[model samples]
Target: MRTVHEVSGLAGVSIRTLQYYDKIGLLRPAGYTDAGYRLYDDTDLERLQQILLFRELEFPLKEIRKIMESPDYDRDRALEQQIALLTLKKEHLENLIELARGIKETGGNTMDFSAFDTSRMEEYAAQAKASWGDTAAYKEFKEKAKDRTSEEERDLGAQMMRIFAEFGRIKDTDPASGEAQALAGKLQAFITEHYYKCTEDILSGLGRMYAAGGDFTENIDGAGGKGTAGFADKAIQIYCSRRGAAANCSMEE
Candidate 1:
């Protein structure tokens, strides 16, 4: 685990900015020391890398959080878009460099200003953002959430956590057992009822996120007991596997 100071140094992000991120629920640390110092683990660092990439593409922090928190968020897809955007940025810079050289060589007589136009980059970014937000599941979630009050949202969140608390009670048993599988089904149904349709692919992605060692893990473990997130993830994996959806449920390190 790395301290906040170490992470700030390693990531070239100011400590104040990191603190602001934590405050805004953007990038939470893994844990805190006895003395109250924030500590980040490898998973946290990976999330930081994603945030940095999105920032490089000029995504607003609010948009970044929304995109990353989406159930359908795919790291590979985000990376591809980032690569494309960065390539465009690189090409734009090269054009500006060539333009500068031409102007210098022409003794400031060159009237070409096309190199300063960033419409292509701006349009591509808009399309990318639209694509991220255009998923059916995302649209459904927004529709469901649009009418919810703060109290209703909190109530739903607490109800879901209570399901994890149930998982905590049986976490020590075999995750593939009938009871565990039933609980996993219950959780899936709950998500579909309250949020978006929880397809096997989406559930598997959520399972990975639960044990990915960040706020989701911390919150689940807190609701249940220690290791509850991993237990639930295993149960979810087994549950999905039995239905021939295992191909989408493989856990990654």
Candidate 2:
């Protein structure tokens, strides 16, 4: 058994936070001492670790409590699920890096959607235009893309998709590394080339959109393999941050 202070120091959480967790029954103590001090056991510490992990993932307190208290709760299985989700997020970021690279090399003129359904390109374009049509950048994107032939669009889209796939393979790299940042820069350039100027304002909005679920997220995730959208969103935010632009890096959807 250990005191609240010991648990706090070990978990790196504040004494107040632990106290509150106990008060709220989010993490009750294993027992109390004769002196009225709170104490926790190994099981309590393990449960605390799970709570912290869920917190990192931004799960609401209530949601985390419910999940942890569920009769079906299995710590090992939960950890596996967490790992899979995090891995998907990492892959998503890597895909954005690759997509950005393609944009830099080809000036945002390629699209490789082999991993995606080819029939969905038109649908995606329509949805994109509808989503951002009111923006000046969307207008510019339409004008620039208007003259491209169907075959040209297909080829370009395919190439871009291939880049996203490459990112998924390299998702384990540091997001702030030269390679990651370079990919980020490429992504910004790609957006500026194909869509709009991609200013910090635009980039921030796009980042949120990528993280937000829907067709765009689906497109990137599908092409890049399950987590590309979130990954791209993070890379874009990092890229914008490096440029001293306002960036929202929250993973909350």
Which prediction has the highest lDDT against the true structure?
Answer: 1
Native-to-model Cα distance after best TM-score fit, residue 23 in candidate 1, in Å: 0.5
lDDT of 1 by residue, 169-216 (tens): 999999999999999999999999999998775776677557645466
Give the best candidate by TM-score: 1
Model 1 clashing-pair count: 0
The TM-score values for the models, in the order shown, are: 0.54, 0.42
> Which clashing pairs does model 1 show?
none
Q: Tell me the tens digit of each residue's lDDT in model 2 across 99-211.
A: 77887999878686433322222322233323323556657877888899989888877766766666555556666667666666776777787656877656655665555
TM-score of 2: 0.42
Worst 10 residues of 1 by lDDT: 244-253
Report RMSD for candidate 2. Answer: 18.3
- List residue ranges in candidate 1 displaced over 4 A: 134-253
Report the CA-based lDDT of candidate 1 relative to the real structure.
Answer: 0.86
